[model samples]
Target: MAGSLWYATAAPGPVLGPLTASVRAEVAIIGAGYTGLSAALRLAEAGRDVVVLEALEVGERASGLNGGQVIPGVKHDPDILEEMFGPVAGSRLVDTVASGPDVVFDLIRKYEIACAATRTGWIQPATSPATLEVIAARVGQWRRRGADVELLSAAETARLIGSQRYLGAWIDRRGGTIQPLSYVRGLARAARGAGARIFSQSPATDLEETHSEWRIQTPQGSVVSAMVIIATDAYTDRLVDPLRRTLIPVPSFQVATEPICDELRQTILPEGQSASDTWHLLRYFRLDPTGRLVMGSRGTFADVPVAVAARHHYRAVREIFPQLEGIRYEYHWGGLVGMTRDHLPHLHEIAPGLLTGLGYNGRGVAMATVMGRILADWALGMPGPELAFPVTPLAPIPMHRFNQFGARMVIQGLRAMDGLARVRDRWSARSAPGLSL
Candidate 1:
């Protein structure tokens, strides 16, 4: 499927080897993705001797494999959170996610990270009338909460995106884009520079309480740590049972075109706006500096080359702009996203010295990095309130085992619904005289 695409086009990078001997540290972190690396960087900077154990090299997984859309905010709506967590906690969560991009960009600038970071902004384009209403409501909620957000008219959105397919959209300039793998690698290098010892291919096997401290048993050796952090996300192992129980792993896929002509590229999201369609099974796209169209979706890929997935993505490109067709595709790849039932991230204390953070849904680029900083602060004996953001263990979804199977069924159902909605919209557009195309 599309999974094979990533293997063909991934950048040449070092793959970490297995841990051959035992080691020790003050704090041992599992998984070297954004969350773990971010945590390690912050801790090392504070003079904490930290050791990060990774099953693979840094940015070997989703951190390295994504569409590179650095959009901000949590996956769920703010009102939905408020209804679920009460006004106080909900508002706090909203404020945290809304400002996450700033936190990320500031870190990049401060640390001199070489990732191709940009504040090009993002647009949630309404694909249909129903989805248009949803987008409009989101714009209203963001504005009401004092977010720097704007709702565009059909003409304004067309002018901005050079596509008339989207009815309208919600634009948030604070949300931007980045080269994901480079950013993750840069973070790891910074952490190492700050005195953190990061061991690749050292996967933690067992995390047990040893007296008052924590012992992380890895394939090569064991480290006795004052505290331990697990930030593996979807690749989270059975090292900790509670963590597996809290987060659900889901697969996400992406495809990239070779490069478009300057004229075509300029007319398609010319403002450097990352665009996502408003559908249950959504499509997101952005242009890389090389002029490649990196697009992604939520479903599994069929027996297609990276070119086929690229074609599918380009088809999506064509749907938005009929002007673009027959574009060449170069790469395709997929990654797993660890998610929670409520679409919120999970941070829980499984034992006295063991802590876990996972389930970023798909907003890991910014949220995961921010969470890493929070994880380090927690490790350094800092109080939760003292940390810039909040981290709490959410109640595990009841019958989570069954929910995994149920999740696939729900996705299939949503895909069907999305198809039906598209048909209905096309019919309405054809029959209604007052509906402007």
Candidate 2:
């Protein structure tokens, strides 16, 4: 079931009976993931009649099949944005993202959502010397931008992570983790409770623009709405062709162990913070409330397992924690991340009465939830720059359909280069003259 884990290992109690006939609504939202459901909740709360069309069920794709990392802010670094667009505009963007988590938390609390929400924070661990430098710089940049962040030394990092493989880490209290599927499903429930109509197992096949209204056709019915929001992310490529071209689908995989030793659980991530290494192809791991070590990483493997992409995650997890060697991986799964060419989110005003927001580049958990609220506000005629990200929509990658080959090549090449750098750093540490070496 697409939303099984999200509804706490049970399938979404028979998706809201499908839309069997024509309906009219103030807004029709396509895709019932975090973005769509969150927006539905917001719009419904404001007394607007909203209808959500989901292909399968709420949180069916990446929204539910993700690492559950509730990261704060947009994917791009502030310094990079500053260089591209001057400090003023860049600062504002950074400021908005810095406050995004609070907005999401407020909605969760207000709606009384039960997604096992936790604010235990997150740590950016450095796997190599170069990575340490980058993490240190990011910590400084975030601090200067008024984020509650700090860079930790190797000793402190080890104390926090119980792993000597990392050289240092960047700690931030703003970020956290969640049971992603649960959060989005909870949002759907909240939206319904607020008087929104959600039709699951219904995909918006055709979007018709008629006399200033948007008509979305599903399998068995249609919704004529004053406004429409395309909140599918990776799934948007199906209905919107240009979106498929602009947003590259990158696959991310995860695996979960049955449970670790009690001693290991007590020592490693006991406080429950989500942790990821500072690598382009990163490894993220966190323990569940039940002590299962759920681990994830970038890149696909040749062999796919029956359970949640287990083998790929197993290899990556073992590399970091050799103690877990030969352990059985009980849960395995994979999902596609809608990665933009420039590694930023996409917010497009496709036409009057129709808007689309997608391409979160793997940070969709909080970003999608927060963006949903903003998109709902935009549909209600909220004016200002906050409704959308300012970057002009660029042309899709040349021959984007052929990008799978390119993405694979780039990932493998980067991993090789990073491996070489790690070797050099290790050799240098062993050869140092005066100190312990």
Candidate 3:
């Protein structure tokens, strides 16, 4: 449990040197993660001269360190989305998110990204009957919209998951998994091939509007462009104070076991599908191409200790797959997730020539990729009403400086609630002999 397993194993790609001198482009993108890289690729394909500025190497932050679970839909359900933004806008949002995975896999294929991409599907298991109801409703809503999603019965869920811990589950064939770091690097490669320039280790220290153009100053050089994109999700810096204050950054910790024996792999996630439970503090697990079992969950914002946080993930793995009680974990790491108050991705025009997008909650993998295209479209003069996500004014979150403390409290409270729910679920199962827990 030390560094990122993705970076440790994935094959390296061409590295872009840092910005060395002043450059001019039609569009300058800040941050070289999924969103920024994707926007760069699309813009380059559209024949726009674009330059991407990265603080570190590409995919060095949340983009490369994420769970790599390619889930569909917004953070919330379709019905909830409709309720939040009304029927027309909500349905449009739902349609956009539902197509996210296609955008991801298509890029991988078109670019020949060697990220161990898998489209086996994604599963959401329900640990209790109440959660099962939620899954059922979700399946129904998605199915009504012609998505290839289905609700599994208790026996079917157990068979597919190789665990009796869940009462039911929902499966979306559109979802998948990938080596995220490799995917991002491949995107950089493709973007470069399409004539976009990417500068690594170049942090944008200052952003200002000069006349009708945007000027971004880096330590080594500067980028002057007609438009700029702040695609720096959870790792937002002080340069974009308004965008930074609009969301809370929460950490997600992950641990992966050494590749298990083929026999053991057959007994866990046999279908090779990624899965997560329906809990306030959720746990997600998947099998890498080499059979290593990877799992992750919510973590603290403050640096209390790594061993303390790693223990929770270890306990969760053991609880689900009892056969691997003493499995040796090979990697441990965490990354920040930009969570918005409404738990949906945010797209905004902070000023006339400056635009920014962030707050993917925990669904950054697919959402971020889709957001890049949307951002590129916006930069190409697409109207706000025609965009996938609504473009709104940037509003700072109230008391954002104290958000870390609030995040810690919320994590603790959710953990307690989850524990209590498990206890109550077990009690109810014992009381009603025929009931499924």
Best by lDDT: 3
> For residues 297-380, what per-residue lDDT tens digits would candidate 3 score against the true structure?
987655688888898888888888888988999999999988887777899999987888888888889999999999999999
Which scores higher on TM-score, 2 or 3? 3
TM-score of each: 0.89, 0.91, 0.96
How does candidate 2 fare on TM-score? 0.91
User: Model 3: runs farther than 4 Å from truth?
Assistant: 426-437
Between prediction 2 and prediction 3, the one with superior lDDT is: 3
Residue-by-residue lDDT tens digits, candidate 1, 317-424: 677667767666577677787877666776666676676677888888888888888788788887765555556764666787887777667767766666676667
Q: What is the number of backbone collisions in each predicted candidate, taken in the order shown?
A: 0, 5, 0
Any idea how many clashes model 3 has? 0
- Give lDDT tens digits, candidate 2, residues 313-352: 6767777777777777667677788877777777777777
Computed on alpha carbons, the lDDT of every model, listed in order, comes to 0.75, 0.75, 0.88
Q: How many clashing pairs in candidate 1? A: 0
Q: Which ten residues in a row have the lowest lDDT in candidate 3?
A: 428-437
The TM-score of predicted model 1 comes to 0.89
The superposed Cα distance between candidate 3 and the true structure at residue 240, in angstroms, equals: 0.8
Candidate 2's error at 170, in angstroms? 0.6
